[model samples]
Target: MSNLLSGETSPYLLQHAGQPVHWFPWGPAALERARRDDRPILLSIGYSACHWCHVMAHESFDDEATAALMNRLFVNIKVDREERPDLDQIYQTAHQLLTRQGGGWPLTVFLAPDGTPFHSGTYYPPEARHGRPAWRDLLESVAAAWQSQRGAIDQQGEAVRQALARTTPQATASEPAAVLAALGGPLQAVAGAWLAQRHDREHGGFGGAPKFPHATDLAWLLERGVAEGDGDARDIALLTLTRMAQGGLQDQLGGGFFRYSVDERWQIPHFEKMLSDNGLLLGLYAEATALTGDPLHGRAVEDGAGWLMREMQAPEGGYLSSLDADVEGREGRHYVWTSEEVRAALTPLEWDLASAHWDLIAAPNFEARHWHLGVVRPTAQLAATFDQPQAAIDEIITTVRAKLLARREQRLPPGRDDKVLTSWNALAITGMVRAAGLAGRPDWLQSARRAADFIHDHLWIEHQGRHRLLATWKDGQARFDAYLDDHAFLIEAMLALLQADFRLEDLRFAQALADELLDGFEDTAQGGFFFTRHDHERLIHRTKTGRDQALPSGNASAAWALQRLGHLVSEPRYLRAAERTLLLFAAEVAHQPGAWSRLLQAAVEQQCPPALIVLRGPQAREWRDALLQRCLPHTLVLAPPDATTGLPAPLDHPLPAAGGTTAWVCSGTQCLPPVHRLDELLAGLAPAPAPPTGR
Candidate 1:
């Protein structure tokens, strides 16, 4: 019989409700049933968008024999990792604690009747290969182990539970300065080490096969370098961004980025684009383009934003979650094309321009007729080959891409995961708002606001000052206690909206929600926050910390939002939380800097933390124009300074003031002399002062 998860709204859960494994969804019902029946729970965790997840389901979960074995031997449980990331986090941590290794999706964790983990691993193939155990064998062996070592297994479970209980604050630095002071050298060392190992002379990204576009960290180091006038950092960041723009991982046809590169030089991608990746990368590229004015980088943002609007849009106008990798059981099949295909698709001159611009050679990055990627030709070379100015070729290519994209729409497209997850959607909204800033597209901002309205109106269920967050969507079913990520990212979206237009309700709601998060999920003793809230029923063990993983940890992202909120509103407690979360995870961030870009953003949140650096009075709009002319990336700029910018009173120096012409560079509560000239304002916003010591 199916359990409570069967009645849930999550597409992932609904997909499994009919499984023969007698499945239970991760909840009190499943936990209670398992405990009452004295059956170990075979917990399988994955998401709908995951390709391998579908593979495992087809290979094992769908197989009657495998399902029979699972049902007969244990209380089988299926979990949508996106829905219960908190549950995913707890078990993922336990899997690490037990194995001294890490964990990921299609995660197989054997739990005792009471929900404590006994063993855990991920993605067991139907048949053993490459030194990993097969699913059938693994199930049999685990079952045998459980039966034979019941007493020992219980003892071991107890020990793991004890180990988890001991996951208290190890050593968190007290202040933001102290945390940064601690992180600076270590993060620099890590960046230097990664950069040294890079094939940098190639002017591309780091590492080889199965390459991910983790440009955030690299960009951070570069931003820091630019901020500090360090040539290497800017060089590293700029080169990487430019090269990535030209690479195959960038969708040359449709104008978005795939998940990652499959080979070296980023020539070919695994061919699944995500909203979060494109959104985050677009923000990076826009900032870089603003600084360098490389039209190609600008092209990247334009194309990517175009893709977001055209492809990912929901019927209600918010972004859909993701596009599947497989269309006909073939990965990268739909996106790839050949030289002949391109020639047929375009006019004579257009074909030649495309070929020259793309460096079409015999061995494209694909296997069959229409698969693989080509390196990009520099614009100058394209201009020479096409016998036209570079601008003309660019326009042609852009026009051709649009036509082809429209034509390609006639073909079967990748399946879109339609579940509108709150947390993931929040990230999408963040991207939309950020995209709006770069592209001046009100549609993107409107998209963000609509989603915010959807979440606030639909997803929220109030119970006597308490709130619950749900994970999935159809017509209208967003129920479940929203996790740390949902709260954190939505809070971020609220903040962004407030900044875009100084709305009181936005600030008030964001603040109220942030307080709710702090109350529920704050790891008071530990520096970082927990994934699950206090009201959440305790799992096998509570997971308070986070790994950077594929996405930024909710904890880290929340810390970032808090710091940004603190800067925007001139609050100190938010800064305190930000510092705490960082210190709590300092050990991990110190070791794996790549995973913690949001943490880095949080650190840099203070780097130029908005301390009343308001350009006001008669010289203000001119000062605003000046600030926009320069690249003060990471600073909050109010074009027509509004009331959200709480500038301090009593200007000391005689400054020009025609209401909006004055630019006030206030440090905390103290306003600096108003500066009409651009050069003078530059010196004022160089770096922000530390938050007052005691608060």
Candidate 2:
């Protein structure tokens, strides 16, 4: 029988609709039921693509006995974390506070009737093992506790609520100039030092096992390397990029990256592919390719771009959320291979070269002796080993991969969560725009525009007599109030889209979002934007933070987009809001600069305003494209379709009454002499006298 979630649009919620457990979606009715029955609420939060979520569901949710226990003991409620990040954020934080441990998906919590959490945990096994209690036993114990220790649990819940309310960043007011100066020296220095220490010299990424892509850190370091002339930072960033491309975390047969690697070597990944991770990583790869001219980075951009377009794009235009890690009820089933399958797919000669190059000849690395392909040797080395030319080896390996991929496609594929999210789609747009500009691929730019158009048409709407953005859309229904991330990321995407292919409507939309951002989300007194809007549903806490987690924080992104938009149109109000945001989070950002790299990058941009290049004439598009080909981290390019009249400030300034395309480089109102040639314009925007050669 279908539960209440059968009617829901969230793929995660719908996945559990057929479970024997009588699950209720998180809402007033579920809370009211718990209160009416005097039962605790068993809130289970997980996303569709989470592998442990699947494991827990199969082991417990599908078991009739366990479901019976839950029905009798608690008012079972299910939530899709992706759908309700506000609820997830509060509960995840509460779990960490109550248990003194980090939190992950399949988050299980027992809540009071009023929705305050008293006990929290992550995945529990079906039977007692690994020192964790079985699900059924835990349910019985919790029910007994509800009756015997109700007062104590209520007290604990109140204490947690109070602790959550007290969580806020240290905020203070300062001039933009002062914040910029402090960021340039003390904050940047601390960040650099921390990155240097954290860098894995032998392997690439930071920390130990279970490494994340950490796209923000890589991006910030790249900017510092180019703009600030820091070679160590540059080297670390490049090394990490190269290693990740060669690792198994990146799909060897297909394109796109996995969620994270479970080992230091990046040889084994968690296998789920998220749209958010790929979008941010794609943007990084595009920027890195532009700056360093690394073939590997370019290949990553191409591969990831292909994967997103072919596999993730919805027919209507927006990108889907994620691809599950498991297939056929086994982890990494669709990705890993046995020796027999590899042997059967390739010719003798092709097999010899491919196995040597891809490490298929080695001992198996996964469960039941299956192998997860990771590069063990270069193709050049394989050629040397076989005494053949590199070209012959490459040809043979190419054919071998085609055969393998074709055969692999016959297997049952992992499930896809096809719901569209505004923030994630905006990230994809930004990535595609960068890749298109750097690679000179117009089709990629169009992909970005299509997604943007979809957002503008569907997600952006007039609500309550003001412009508003919706967070998620599915099956012709858009729900949930837009969070700070949705607005900030879309604004950033529009700015990128304008650079790739200018659109008047997109610019107008960006401005509208910025206006709504200030009006609905910003903390006028304290300065930074809150995660939720002013009229959002009341949760235990209303958070305003600057740290980058799995995704970049909304506050950091808003400050970034606002500053750029402010500079583009000579708008002091936008610039001031951005400045105040930086000052508000300055102390927290300074303390853990590495973790807060996104905010620090915004500070760098604020301190040294990027060049504003405005092109005017018949050949303006040509000049704009030429400048975009180069890596201009601190530059904004504006190429209006027609004559530059009635535009704001420097953009409104008339073009030289001449034949050739004329360009003006400005820092606010101060302008450089007009340049007609592309090289001359490039010289004007160059960050330093001599630039670092590509890797």
Candidate 3:
């Protein structure tokens, strides 16, 4: 029979509502029952978007015999990984520690009644496949161990609990200059150190195999090099990005990135695509494009967001969680293809063009009847491979894709996690707003606004004269208050919406959200914000940390969000909060500079902010564009009092520029005189001339 999770809002929980295995959503009752009955807890965590999660469910959860066995011995507690990343982290860590390896989705933790983990692993198959152990064997082994070693397991649990308690946040230096200097002063040196330790000198990327794009570190190094005029760092970062872009890991035709490459040259990838990864990568690409004016970066971002909008964004306006790696119950089966199928699909001329473009040359990765997948073609060679002109080839490919897509639809696709997660939706909002600003797509901006509205209307609640954000959305029920990542990323989204749409309500809301973050989420004694709020019903314990994972740690993200909010509101307190957050992790960041690239980026923001406030008349479109042209490199243009809600000006940051289509350049607190001509504004903004260009 189905359990309480059936009525839950989380799509992950609801996905299992029809399972023969009786499951209970995380609650006091399940914990209490486990304690009273002295049964081990079988805690399963994998979101709705996970393909393997669906596989394990269909193979095991739907089977009556497996369900009966599971229900009889273990008190099964299921959780949506998206909703409780902290809990996931804690248990996943325990699992990995016990197994002498790593852990991921469909995380199965075998824990004692008192909640100490004895064993854990991810996704056991019904029968042995790929040389892995079978699910039945694993279940029986765990059950036997739990029964025989109950006392030993409790002692191990007690020791782990102590280690967890020891890691909670305690205040560090109230100021963060030590943190900044510690991180910034040695970033290049540390990056070089890490590279010196193991960089693949010839192939690019960091590791030996199973490569993931270290996009943030590369972007930071690029930014730093540009900031310092150091060419070597820039070249290394650019080369890495270039190779990845050309590699098979990139969906050359479809326009989104795969999860990670299994080889050094990025030939094959784990096919899941996440919204958070796209958002951060898009923002990074946009920055890269602006810095270098490289057409590839610009086009890649264009294609990436295009795929995001077309494939992922849900009907409810917010984007979906992910696209699974597997389709038709086989990994990469749908995406891989046979040469004959291609030959049948196109003419001889088209075949010649398509074959070369798709790299049908090296050796067909697929079998004769069933095509095994291989690497994609190099980007530089693709334009020349197509028989038709580049534009025509693109058109033909689009048409061809339509036919393939239709045929693929006939085969059931991987399951989608439709639940709108606040953190991930926040990521999508930023990406959409950035696309709208850089690519000049107002429709994208509108799309961002729709998501913002969804969050505000559906997830936020006002009670006791305060605003609280919810974490999950399934049916009608919304439970579990927002975490640090939610508030942090959402605040960034709020500011982004204001920048893109110039909406005052959004600005107001962003500030209100920031206030909530500062008030309750802040680690007032310790300095950086805590991941979970103090009032969050006291879980086993709170975790205070920062690291870059698929997204980033809530603490680190909060640090950047606070820094951005500081710029938006001209608030020094937010700056201090950013400082404290980074400093809290100063030792770790000092040790591994490359890992904390996000924190370092925020550190760069602290040094110099490109903040500007513009003032002009209602009919100031021409004036605004002119100012924008001059300030394109770095500047935030603001509207005059007349253009805005005409909200009462604060004494601290009054609107200083003159009215009636005039422009002023301000740095920090200094405002220059107004000018009517774009040339004059450019001259005022430009540095003193040296010699003639034709010397």
TM-scores of the candidates are 0.87, 0.96, 0.88
lDDT of 1 by residue, 1-695 (tens): 54445577667777677766788777677778788878888999987666777788878888999888887888888888866777787887889999998686778899998888999988888999988899999989998998899999999999998998887446544565766766644575574556546636475666677677775565565566656676766777777777777788888778888888767777877677777777678767766666666777777877877787787877675566778777777777677777777777889887777776676654565676554544467767777765778678768877777767777777899877676778767776776666566556677678678877777777766768665555556666665677788788888888667545435567767877788778878877756677777878767676665555566678878887887677656567887888777777777767665556567656655444544444445455545444543455465554333433333232222334454355556544545565666666676565422121110
Of models 2 and 3, which has the larger lDDT?
2
Best by lDDT: 2
Against the hidden true structure, what lDDT does model 2 obtain? 0.85
Q: Name the regions of candidate 3 deviating beyond 4 angstroms.
A: 1-4, 127-133, 173-176, 192-204, 291-295, 366-411, 613-637, 645-695
The local lDDT score (0 to 100) that residue 257 gets in candidate 2 is: 96
Q: Poorest 10 consecutive residues of model 3 by lDDT? A: 686-695
**Given candidate 3, what's the lDDT at residue 239?**
64
Give the CA lDDT, 0 to 100, for residue 270 in model 2. 97
Residue-level lDDT of model 3, residues 1-695, one tens digit each, is 34667777777788788787879888788888899988888999997657678789889988899988899888898888888887887887677667778888899888777677888889989998887788888889889988888678778777777777776656564355655765656664676566435555565677878888777667666666666666766666766666666566666656677777877877777777777777767766665555555556666677787777788777777777777777766666556667777677677766665666566655765444443333254323455644335566555655665555555556666556667778888988887777666656667777778888988888888868888888767554566888888998898788666555566777777778788888878887767777787787656657777766667667777777777666656788877888777777776665665577667666556555555545556544554433432214235565544536534232123333554455655555566666566566656553322221110
The total number of steric clashes, by the backbone 3 Å criterion, in model 3 comes to 5
Q: Cα lDDT of model 1 overall?
A: 0.70
Error of 3 at 384 (Å): 5.6
Top of the candidates by TM-score: 2
